[model samples]
Target chain A: MIAPALHLDGSARYDGTPVFSDLSLRVPAGEWTCLLGPSGVGKSTILRLFAGADTGADFDGSFGADDGAPLDGRMALMAQDDLLLPWLDLRANVAIGARLRGEAPDLARAEATLARVGLAGMETRRPAELSGGQRQRVALARTLMEDRPIVLLDEPFSALDARTRSQMQDLTAETLAARTVLLVTHDPAEAARLGHHILIMGPNSVTPVAPPAGPIPRPVDAADVLGAQADLLRQLRGLPE
Target chain B: MSGWRAGILSALLGVAVWQAVVWATGLPRFILPGPGLVATTIWKSRALIAEHALITMTEVIAGLILGTVLGALSAVGLAASKWARTLVRPMLVFSQAIPVFALAPILTLWFGYGLGSKVVMALIIIYFPVTSSFFDALMRPNRDWIGLARVMGASPARIMWHIRIPAALPGLASGVRLAAVYAPIGAIIGEWVGASKGLGYLMLLANGRAKTDLMFAALIVLAVFTILIHAVVSRIATRLLERY
Candidate 1:
């Protein structure tokens, strides 16, 4: 599917407290847009808003596909929690979207998706039997099986150990390559490594942060990547440099 | 130890304790029959006890099936609709507050002195526990899974069928296990209130005739039956839990 760019211009309030106001952002079509900010800045809320999920907040805004189409049924989401149903094995979990929608799941396709996520031949393993990283891979496989044009990830790799987190970043960057991806993260290095267009969201405003010049799934030790990571860190910390 | 071996050992211990109590109390044989006397009576009246045991078993099983189905449906309905929750949950709680055991005589009067009254009694006794536990679990599904299903564009019915129901199976299993133990109580009470045949009715008959040994045998059969049902239900519940 050709990914459509998305636009959100509005404000939201949670329990009568303002989450964000006058927030305007663009997720350029078919590219990675990383949203970075401190906790409670509503970065994940924006992702929720775009994914058509309940944000537990009253939102008054215009958010839609750049193609002027409704975003429903064209989106998939991955959260820090893998959200695999414990009762179902890996393949069934990967095909859960179709099953939940009352469609006959394509088991062959689900197996292939698992293989794509490097979990080949583990189709019958329950979520409990797998390591945390393996479970996240199953989640990734589920997300990929949906094949939606827009994918929203809320700190999907933050729970992993340092090494596993970096590995996951690389896999996700490669797998979700052509989709309209919006990643919400608090990790500066993550944004620097994967974001094609980065936006640092403060309490009330959204500002675009320039990424280091390179192809995404960027080398971890690259000089510009480290520089960009440090700069994003400083910017987020309100530390002028 | 194997389960059967442990169970046999426990039964032996219980019998020994019962025999000791009988010897210590020196109660009249009619008042407290010893294990040996009860065993002899059981063997001699095996056919008679079996006939009555069959009736009570039928009542308990029928009640269990009916209660489990009705309770499961009520729980799912409550979970699925806010209207059902608002309108029915209070009534369910109110029903529980009315002690169900006290309703046995009335149930017998309405359903008559046969199997129907016994079954209805069993159903009423177990309905609330099954509904309450299953409904509570249904209401509190894993939030993240529900969110994920919603984002996948699942309809409410589809979500309930594929997610909520399966997630709540363990809860439902627990309810059924509880119902197994409680079902015999309902059936026996209904039989006690008014019945032509059943283990409960036989015990009452034997007591009136001062055939205490026969009454003791009947009581032992009832106890053994209840324990057997509980063990079977527990095994099934554990398997269901493991599978789901």
Candidate 2:
């Protein structure tokens, strides 16, 4: 399915204190949109809103797909924690969406997806047996199995080592190609490398930040990517560019 | 060392110490029979002791099964509904404030001196630990996993079954371990209050007749039985932890 563009314009408050008011942003369909900001700037709250998760705050305004339909049942999320059930094997974890919905899990499809994520012949291993990167690969496989048009990633690779992070970035980008992905992250380098359209969010407003002039999963040490990364870091630090 | 070897070595050491105490104290045969005399008494009265032990064992096993099932069900019920948690949780806590052992006489009075009262006694003793531990675990599932499951469009019942209950199995196993140790106490107390059979009744009968050797033998049997139950339950609990 072709991804639908997401448009959200809303205000949020917690315990009668406003988090952000008149915040508006659009995630273009079939591309990556990275929302980067300092911690506690409601970046994850925005993703939660799109994913239809409980935000633990009062949200006022309209947010929906530009196709004029609700985004429910059309989105999958990958959080900082892989969220794999420890008791389940890799195949079972990947196929949890079907089992959880009381449908017969397609075990063959789960095995195929595991192989797609490069976890072939390891489908029976538990999460505890896998390394951080391998576990995240299983998480990626689970997300792919959801088969949704929209994917929300909330710092999904933030816990990995630098080398593993880059490798996973490449894997996720390739596997989720052409899906509408809204990635919320604090790392400016990640935004510079992966975001097709970038938005820098502060306490009250969202500003468009132009990424490097290239496709996503951009080389880390490329001159333009480094320039964009430095510019993003300076912008985040509130310095004159 | 292997568990069995360690256990046997401990038992031998315990018997040696008991013999040393008997020799040092010079107590009368009726007052403190030596380990040798107790062992002989156990052999001589094995048939009689076995009869009473079978009764107590039956009571304990029945109570363990019933208590575990009831406690697990209550935990799930409490986890699934806010009303059950609000209305029943406080009642559960209040019930624990009343010492379960003190209720044995009342239970015997109500259910009579038959197996009914003994089973009820054991059930009451174990019900709280199992319910509370499992309920606490069910309420505290991994937030990220639950969030993911919710976004997957899983029904509430499916989430409870596939996620919450499985996540809480270790907690339930812990409760079962505690129940294994406590169940025997409840059954024995019930038998003490009033019962035609059971190891507790045998102990009291021997004591009344001044057959202290027989009394010591029965007490030892009861202790051994309780330890065996705990070992088995512990193994089961460890398997639950490892499997999950």
Candidate 3:
């Protein structure tokens, strides 16, 4: 039997302002879930909650991973910021999490992961030495070294040029394989392209975009998902009246 | 113009102005010896002045190493605890307020008339800058850099050894340069109080005997040691901190 990927129920807020409320959702193992919304609509907030950054905040929520354990090595998160250590060269940066885990052959795993993310042969360059696209690729490479069942990406391609961005999206699609991916992307086309299911977040709620016969998928029709997001927004806006 | 050429031209221009002033004013040699006379005296007494200068040099080097280690430890202690920081930092700040002259007497008394007192005085003088610079350096890792390290799952110890210490190298080197310059001067001050032998001792003897040229020559020796120490330290600093 497949374990549940993640479950978020109830509201999460910042300061006193409500961000997401009564927003219960579940992602199954090996499925990609895209959190789609306009800016300031709490898409990023949901990611943070799932990643366990929302500590001591004014919120009422139960976020439980499979097996009832607080999400630990079972999940890996990559923020929009690459956050590479300036002092370390590339290979060491990717190996950091493995080193933290005290795993042997961590450097070898790091190198393999680097190759998986299309960052082959650039292991010795410092963060400053790499281009922005290269840095993000390194970050994505680092994320893969975790080999966790779940992965979170927050606007990972927002900084890349279109060619690099498309390459990254392709790299992400290939590298992630069937991991439970919770992606926060503003690009409707991107959401339509890669998401297994689109969750439109707005009006402080995560409302699933009504699907076709099956889950939304890579090579999906952008117009279809964009129309779904628009309809969801309309439905949410109407509720305020 | 090339930097070296410009430096040479500036030096010549200054010396020419000095010679003109000396000739125009007819100032007594004891009061304001001309650069030429000083140079000649330095060349003539180079061996004697250098012997005493070597003692001063040895004192500076020893004091500098001892001071740096003590200062670095104090910085680590201050950074390690809030109580230490509160107690130690203000005391360090107020330390400068205590006249070095007043403190010199006490340091000499405690350590005594041996070269040990001079070394202690140098350590005291150099300690302030080293501690302050190290404090700034150590605290730097506690900022956004640490955030990156934590997010990458780097343990606190790894962060300190790899990122924090390496990052602080630049500031630490700068502090070392400042301390090196002060080390010799601080030793000389202790020597002035009452030393049997040193460049300072030689200067006192020369002054008492009305050996104006010898006094000027000793001053040149001190200057040479200062420049030599400064150059060596600066070179090491450049090599160590160029990465940062």
Candidate 4:
């Protein structure tokens, strides 16, 4: 699949306060771009803008695919909350997008995706019956089942413990390799681990930082990842590097 | 203890207390029938009481089914549209402001002194709780679930049916439980206003004829029937909550 480049030139205001003004960025096709910032720097807002999910914000933007076609129905967003329906079991939850689209749920494919997310044999368990990490995995499976060309993630693995978070990061980086991805997170190390190119959003500007030349998920203890992590942290703290 | 055992024990204790009260009061059987006299009356008039009880039961069941269907639909309508909420909801609440007992005569006047009047009475009494409880639940669906559904491009109708309704079912179940207890009150009140063949009418006839023991027997039968209906509704509600 030839992934389309996403371009955005936008300004957004929340409650009459400017979040970002005249902000422009280009995401190359089929690459992972991580948006890293402090807690309230509007990283997730940018992702929401791309996903068209920020309905209440005063946003003025021109967004388009590289081919000049509309972007509707081509993007899927995995929000920070694992918003699994409480009434459905894991399999049905993963298949919800298909069901919502009025298509027959591909249960066999849903089961395979659940297994890929390491949620095998728990297809009958509801969200409330699972652990936090397990629920997050189910949410990930749901996003994967969407099978759209562009994916937006908002702090997708923040709920997982260290080991499971690493596993999920690796799995996502592998599974979503062929799609355009824009991820939002506050974790510098997570950005370093998964992002092919990292964009740091400061109070006034977004700065692009070069990461090490390796496919993610890079070894957490790898020398290149650690170096990029340090540089990312330095940029976040407003230090010259 | 399990529910049945506990219920049986409580009932036996209530009967013992009633017998003690009768012995202590030394009231005459005409004005205040003893437990023994009431018990004998119940056995002897079993056939008459059953006939009336069956009629009352039919009215209560019919009213419950009709009211629940209408209430559930009204709640869905209220949840689905702001216009419905603004227009219909106020009228529903206003209907309750005039006491339901007051409406019994009006309903009897409109529906006539038959099952129609009694069923409408029960329906009127039950409508508010079912609509209110279900509407509250539907209006406040889990925000995260709604967000996810929106992101997935679910239509508003789809979201309401697939997500909101299923999520709000426990609240609907609670409403049904309340309706079970209230249905009989509406039926009996309608019978009191005007009816020919129901427990309420039988009680009134026995009292007018100064048959205190027979009236007590009819009243006891009504009480037991109410408890049984409540138990059945509660059991179904519990199962629904568990499944969904």
Give the TM-score between model 2's chain B and the true chain B: 0.96
Error of 4 at A168 (Å): 0.9
lDDT for each residue of candidate 3 in A74-151, tens digit (9 for 90 to 100): 677776778787767889888777555444537777878888777778787789988888898898887887667788
Q: What are the per-residue Cα lDDT tens digits for candidate 1 across B1-244?
A: 5989999999999999999999999998999999999999999999999999999999999999999999999999999999999999999889888877789889988999999999999999899889999999998898778878888999989999999999999889999999999999999999999998999999999999999999999999999999999999899889878977
How does residue B35 of candidate 1 score in lDDT?
Answer: 96
TM-score of chain B of each: 0.96, 0.96, 0.90, 0.97
TM-scores of all candidate predictions against the true structure: 0.96, 0.96, 0.83, 0.93
Worst 10 residues of 1 chain A by lDDT: A232-241
lDDT of 4 by residue, B1-244 (tens): 5977998999899889988888899878888897788999999999999999999999999999999999999999999999988888788888889998888888999999989999999998998999999989999888767766766778889889889999999889999999999999999999999999999999999999999999999999999999899889989889878887
Superior by DockQ: candidate 1 or candidate 3:
1
Q: lDDT per residue, candidate 1, A96-190, as tens digits?
A: 99998889999999999999989999999999999999999999999999999999999999999999999999999999999999999999999
Which candidate model has the greater lDDT, 1 or 4?
A: 1
lDDT values, one for every candidate? 0.93, 0.93, 0.76, 0.87
lDDT of 2 by residue, A98-213 (tens): 99999999999999999998999999999999999999999999999999999999999999999999999999999999999999999999999999999999888899998899
Steric clash count of candidate 2: 0
Model 1's lDDT to the true fold? 0.93
